[model samples]
Target: MDKHAQKIAADLLHLRGQVLSKGDPVALPLVSSSMFHLPGDPEGAAAYGRVDNPTWDALEHSLSVLEDAPCVAFPSGMAAISAALFATLKAGQTLLIPSDGYYVTRLLSDRFLSQFGVRVVQRPILGFADGGFDGIDVAFIESPSNPGLDLCDIHAIATAVRKAGGTTIVDNTTMTPFGQRPLDLGVDMVVASDTKAPGGHSDLLMGHVATRNTALRDAVLDWRKMSGAIPAPHAAWLLHRGLETLDVRFDRMCQSAAIIAPALADHPAITAIRYPGLATDPAHALAKRQMSRFGFLIGLTLDTKDRAEAFITGCRYLRPATSFGGLHSSAERRARWGDDVAGGFVRLSVGCEPVDQLLADLMTSLDRLMSK
Candidate 1:
């Protein structure tokens, strides 16, 4: 592992839940109470679950440590995204978003935020760095953008946005904090869907927004409280547990992807392939400079939707699922979700399967598709 990854692994291993006394539980306690008892003064204590919870405090502390900034937890990724947008943007301000990023984000900006009189501009991932930030009040970026796997220079974009008196927020969901840290690169805020890699298991829905600016952090926190976007205590606890194993799980997934990306690149069945880990990938240089590790997602295209479906069905290990960053490997055709990709475009999320076994399974599936 690289030095950064090694350091993250060490830090994650030493993370411990908040300990109030000598006999406090070593594991993170799941305090599921909706309202805390306040016999005395409730001024400084948590009065209601909607405002705050001890479980969330512990989880957010751990997340803040990982992100190197303060964090606020949310019920889901969209909730976190919404909090960031609503907290920072005003009705007349302009918001810049990736045209090819997570489809839901675009939908939220176009269908919902637009109604609020927020002028939204859509730019492809490659255009972010060179695309002037003039008149933009906020910029939302996703490096190594979803499905397409394109990368942008986060530091450059952040610097430009800041110079223009704008806030920069990055969706670090694809590359979890273990793999990338946007705050260190000068981003104003970092939002992520913990449901992906950080949760590791596909069992819970959770997300968080992290930032070093206290005012921005409090703004997002207020949004969560007012909108009732807080995550359940049990889900928060599960996510905290999931963090313990994230370093190892992410390492294995990246390692497997490094092998799988190259092996599949030259296949006759694949018309195009995009994995930043591959030396031939267009975004490889930028990915190496800005990201600590190449992510697990691989974008590839076949000739037709039937060929893509056949490959997914023929594989023994890869399941057909929309979500990525789980224990089991999975894939999905992006066009089905209106991602503006070809009908045969596939987004493959590498999992923790044995490398050799996983590669063989992928090759077999491709070979079968070629045969048919």
Candidate 2:
């Protein structure tokens, strides 16, 4: 089998040589012990739970295949992001972040980074290449940026950043590794809140960072160890369960978005829509070149925040959720979270469901929104 298929099999069956039993269980048996008997050879595999575990190893290997490099798993998405930040940036360095990404990311930069002596600056994702990377120590790019669905030119921007003695970190959560590979574009690191698509069931919280650069990979690994930001073996197994269906699930979700986005765009109650799958979207041309599949996330604007809330509340198929990439559709009023977006803006996560039923549910909700 090809590498991706092999990785998927590894995720699904967890078939490995280490399972010495006559017939290994299909799932990874979580190792719950905090410490293992190291004896005199502490250098072997299966170290303390904080540093290594078999469950994490299987999933990390699969992710490493997806990213074409080493992978480090974390307890939460922010933990992985924090590891990247703390690993690369020193007190005096400047961090250039996407102004349109997840709200908490902005919070981390503005509220958290400043206290450590690092300077934080915000820039929109669409024109990131022209943002001028000189004197910038780190640049964080979130293509198909959260809530905005804006795309960035990773190659051009990463090239500029490197020439200026800066590093580029791409948040690949929206697209997932199957959708885009930033390492191929010269990014120094790829990080994601695997809690979203990677943990598609929404029952687990996990994150990971992947890098082709050995030094950066080793640094992030060390940071994760020192910070104790490791995922529980059981949580890692749950992430593995969700990831087994990632390729199929992501495709269905993207397909759903392809239909839903244009339909929303045409609705009278909708003021605007941002989805790269639509040819008229500002990010379409660039996304077509950069992404393997247009992402599952959709952004639409209504007349008001109340109307947006009503629309989500009115939907039967789409759940009112702050998260994304599950089996059921969901949406949230992003501005309520203090994101610097339009008060009427909503971030919709397309889920895997029958196309007609999903489309009808959303359109009907909008009709109800208009009636009210």
Candidate 3:
């Protein structure tokens, strides 16, 4: 790695104590086709800001190294997914998505793409033994899906899709590239919401797409130009900076999450604990095969929606909010988003906080909920 790459990597690895000094200013790099050329020389100044920016270039380059695939940063994770889908699928083509897909992707397919002669099919995400993917033009799979926390057999499904002459896309948002690298495991492309782990501080929002195929990269670039969904240079820089410490932050959070998941599994006030690390998790073996870390997100279904609400109100440490994979712990009632996720289900985004402190807060919250 070059000096620049090494600097970024070092920052990421030692995030625990590193702080931006007063003299260090985080500025957005100027958008220039060629920084060496005069600004008045339009031809030499490089392409339009839409195509490239130094900050974004730094992020893209860093991410490319980390993922070991060509990386493209976008305004949001959904935008990366949209751009990839738009670039790959066309009118009169069919796209197969998991039946229980991410709520946003499901909404985008059902509401927006249908009018463009695009057909979105919902394939069952049942285990490999079930042969869930029978026919599909492109298969989109999310292992350990949102809210439901179900796992998909990515390797098996990807093998089936390739044998049938179909494309495969994996949403690696929950696992991030730190926990899993789908491209190495035979998937064509991997998408992530960098707003989570990659931007560990939770102050920025961005997304990324990495693929080994050159043709697909070109297609996504074309779609990105047309859609005007490129992220601002500043956001890209933040993502790049945050990625430096991603492994450390996730390591801490995963350790905490592993402890919390099984501890809550048989809690008297808890109905069920959804975490892939658990031996009882439906996708345990598959997750163990695909992911290095079990991840920091955890789901708990309380006895009832009312009790769920009570638990939400009772929690003192975990903030009642949405979004996960941040420096601070956050909790959310899934039904608040109309997810059909059990009313009492509370999703937890475990952070780098002391695990014992978090556990105490959780136990107290459950006890309070039971009292009510």
On TM-score, the leading prediction is 1
Candidate 3 wrongly placed segments (more than 4 Å): 1-45, 127-135
Clashes of 2: 0
- Candidate 3 lDDT over 107-208, as tens digits, reads 888888877988888755664326444556678888778767788767777888888887888989887776777887899988889998889888888998
TM-score of 2: 0.94
- On residues 1-372, what C-alpha lDDT tens digit does candidate 2 reach at each position? 236644654544443445548787756677778887777867765778888787888888777766778899998899899999889999999999988787788899999898999999888886676659887999998887887888888888999899999999999988887778798888999999988988899899999999988899999999988888889888898887777778888878988888888888999999988888899988788887888788888988998989998899988898898898888889999888888789989999999988789999899989988786
User: Per-candidate TM vs. native?
Assistant: 0.97, 0.94, 0.88
Which of the two candidates, 1 or 3, achieves a greater TM-score against the reference? 1
Ranking by TM-score: 1, 2, 3
* Local distance difference test values of all predictions, in order: 0.91, 0.85, 0.79
Q: Using lDDT as the measure, which candidate wins? A: 1
Clashes of each: 0, 0, 4
Misplaced by over 4 Å in model 2 are: 1-22
Task: Name the candidate, 1 or 2, with the larger lDDT value.
Answer: 1
